[model samples]
Target: MSGMQDRSWWGREARATVALAYPLVLTNLAQALIPATDVVLLGWAGPKVLAAGSLGVNLYNACMIFGVGVMIAASPMMARALGQRAHNVRDVRRTVRQSLWAAVALVIPIWLLLWHSEGILLLFRQEPELAKQASHLIRPMMFGMLPLFVYQVLKSFVSALERPGWAFAAGAFAVFSNAILNYALIFGKFGLPALGLYGAGLGSTISNSVMAVGLAIVVTRHRHFRRYYLFGNFWRPDWARFAQVWRLGLPIAVTLGMEVTIFNAAVFLMGMIGEPELAAHAVAIQIASLCFMVPLGIGQATTVRVGLAYGRHDRVGVGRAGWAAFGVTMVFMVCSASLMLLAPRFLVGLFLDVHTPANAHVIDLAVAFLTVAALFQLVDGAQAVGAGMLRGIHDTAVPMLFAALGYWVIGFGTAILFAFHLGWGGIGVWVGLAAGLAAAAVLMMTRWMRREKLGLI
Candidate 1:
């Protein structure tokens, strides 16, 4: 009877988690599509454009991840509040309001940094012409950063409510709109101006604005969410709550920033190698990132579930939620890794011409990178879900240290040794990637386990 009861309980949790995760997964993939479409469209402009755009995107994302992490503090805060048996709606509303301010405030510095893309690229010793072109691409998109943060905060808000489908729908709409805009502006379709790389940036800016404003309307006007009056006096600042967000969010931001910079560092290293290697690395990483969205969505969902459980002070529930997300992520990653291993050439061909002799070198490098990417899928998913589990309980500080150690000290250091000293080239870089993600996964999962045993949640 006990065994049967256990099985039944697992089944129920599985069903609930799947229901929450699938939409969030689709939302994340749709978000990725905005950039993937840019890559596909921009590839037509030639390798220089592709490489420049890749570098610009990586730099943009490195900054964006920190903002994302800070805004994400809202979801768990709101989720935990809701999970309590008797909680103040005013407290939840205050958190939501303060988070928006924090997000917008964070966006300013990122936008300023993007505006100086050329100087930053030169500081990294990137080629002048490529740096200038990437700078052009970043300028228009700088306008979009504020709206992007707004959209992210709203998405986090809806996800905490366990109503992630609305965010998915908004993102899907944005993807379609972005594709059309890219088509029109990139090649001057339908009497549009020929902007080339700038078109991609403009399209992103317009798409982000649409998504932010559209989601804002939906969030404020939705029947269920209307009760909270999320928009009521939203502009008013709540300093204490803002401080609380900063206290909890800064570490989270640094944690995510550390992880993103690790890959960005790999991009920079590839740049030093050559344009072909850089372009190929871009394609391989894009594919790997697209596959990663599924696990990332599951991880986000796990944060909500576990956060709710923690708010209720249900340690067993937190463990169950975390482990459930881990299991699903592992299974999905296995399937993804198998696909990459079996069809690497086919996948790489999506972004570059694999059969052309002129592109053979890039194709070959990308294939090797994808192979290493496949090898790391298990650990990548583990670290992603583990971080989410820790975030659920508001444990960001230690995980931030763990990420710094794993990604920078171990991951980047090994990449440097293997790429330059051992002469592994691009392949060695990815090998180091696998090692770093594995270390992070072990550390984070162990932290969660220790917390569980000690009833920390």
Candidate 2:
């Protein structure tokens, strides 16, 4: 009877996790499509446009990750509130209100950064013309940053309440809209201006605005959530609640910034090699990142699950939630890695014209990058989910230190040694990334397990 009960409980947990994660996975993929659309449309334009767009996106994301990471605090915070008492509407309302303040505060510096993208790229040693072109693309796209952050905050809000389907629907609609806009604007279709890369930027800006407004309307007007008083006070600031969010969220922002910048730094180093290398790196990284969205969604679901358990002080439930998420992510990533390893040619062909003589070199390098990417998928999935689990427990500060040490101190250092000293080119850089993710995974998982066993949460 005892064993049977344990089995039943595990099954229920797994089902609940899957229920939450499936829609979220699709939503994340849909979110990915915005950029994938840009890559695909811009790829058709030419390698120059593709490379310039990649540079712009890399620079943009390196900064954007911090803001998004900060807003992610809303998930666990709201989850805990609802989990502690399912009808704790005021707490949930407070968290949502405060998160918006943080979002607006975070975007100011990001806007300033985007305004000077040209100077930053030049300082990073990017080619002058490419830097200039990338700055042009990024400047217009900067308008979308606040909206995107707002959407993310709302995404965290709905997701924590276990209402992921609404977010998914909104994101899916945005994806479709973005694709159509990219097609129309990139090539002068549908009587729209052919602004090339700038068109792609404008498409993102418009789609982000749509998503933010759409999600906000859903949250504010939906019958189920209206009870939470989510939009009750339109003009009040709760500095205490805001500080609580920032205290937990700032470390998360720094941790994520460190991780993203590692890759951004890789892009910078690859740029030094040549334009073809940089373009191939961009395509390969984007493809790998798309695959990453699966585990990322699962990780997000785990954050909610673990957070709920933490709020209720259910230690066993917390362990089960984290490990269950870890198991699913590992299985999925293994399959994804297999696809990368076995179908490198088919995968690389998606981003480049493999048949074209001009793209031959790019395709070959991308295949190599994909192979290295395959090796890192497991650790990457582990670390991503592990981080989510820790975040659920409101344990962000130490993990921030861990990520800094792992990604920059160990990961970037290794890349420098392998790529420059050993002369292994871009492949060396990817290998270093794999190493960094492995270290972070070990550290985070170990931390979670120890805390779980000790009943520290």
Candidate 3:
């Protein structure tokens, strides 16, 4: 009877985790699509536009990752409050309100910097033409940043309510709307002017703006979310919670930086190797990124689950939530890893023509990178979910340190040794990525396992 009970409990936890996870997964994938569509539009424009647009996009993404972390803080905060009392209206409302305030504070400085994006690129000694072209793309695209930030806060709000389907609905709408608008604006279709790179930028901005507004409308009008009166006051001060948001959020941003910047760094390293290697890295990274969304979504859902448990002071519930997410993440990672390993060439061909003699060298290198990417899928998922588990318990500082040590010190250091010193080239750089993720996975999961001993519970 005890064995049967254990099995039943695990089954229930697994189902609950997946129930919260699927919609979030689709939402994340939809978020990815907005950018993916931009890439497609740029590719159609030509390689020069594609390259310039990519540079602008990368620069914008760096800031997005950092600033959005502050907004995501509200998720755990609200989740915990809700767990304490299912209808903790005042507290949940304050968190959502402060998250908006935090979003406004975050956007200003980033806007100032992105305004001179071309100059920043030049400061880094990028090609003058590329820098100028990139600025054209960024200037209009930068306007969308605030909308994206606002959208994130709203997303967190809806997600915390466990009504993630609303955000997904908004995101799905953005996907189609962005594609259509970009097509018309970028290519001069349907009586729209062909503004090229500027068109892509403008289209995405409009799409994000509409997405935020649409979601805002739903939250305000929908009977379920309307009771919270999320936007109850246009102006109010919740200084304490506002500071708490930043205090808990900056580490999360830096932790994200450790992972994102390393990959950005690898692009430069590949550039040092050769054009073919650089090209291959881009294709391989995109494939890996798409696969990563599943585990990443699971991690997001895990944060809320674990936070709910943590708020109730239910240690067993916390453990069950965390492990359930980890298990689900592992299962998905394994399937993705197998696919990458078993059919690397076929996957590479999805981006490049396999039969083209001109593409052979780049395709070969991409296949090699995919193989390495497959090797690291499990550790990557482990680290992603582990960070979520820790974040649920309001534990960010130590994990930030772990990320710095592992991703930079251990991970980047090994990449340097293998790629340059040992003459591994592009392949060696991938090895470093694996090493860094592995180190983070081991350290983070270990910390989580010892949560009780460390008084985190």
The prediction achieving the highest lDDT against the true structure is 2
1-457 in candidate 2: lDDT tens per residue?
A: 9999987888788889989998889988988888888888888988888889989988888888888899999999998887799878888888988998998888998898789999999999999999998887798888888998998988998898898999888899999999999899889999888988788889999998998899989988998777877778946888899999999899999999999999999999998888988999989999998999999899899999999999998988988898888988999999999999999989989888889999999999999999999999999999899999999999999999999988998899999899989999999999899889989989998898799465558
Q: Candidate 3, overall lDDT?
A: 0.86
Clashing pairs in 2: none
The per-model lDDT (C-alpha) reads: 0.88, 0.90, 0.86
- The ten-residue window of minimal lDDT in model 3 covers 43-52
Off by over 4 Å in 3: 46-48, 122-125, 353-358
How well does each candidate superpose onto the true structure, as a TM-score? Answer: 0.98, 0.98, 0.95
What tens-digit string does per-residue lDDT give for candidate 1 at 8-72?
A: 87777777788899999999999888888888788767778999999888888888888888988
Residue 321, candidate 1: alpha-carbon lDDT: 90
Candidate 3 lDDT, 173-263, residue by residue in tens: 9999999999998899999999988888898889889889989999999998999999998588989988999999889889987788788
> Rank by lDDT, descending?
2, 1, 3
Off by over 4 Å in 1: 86-88, 453-455
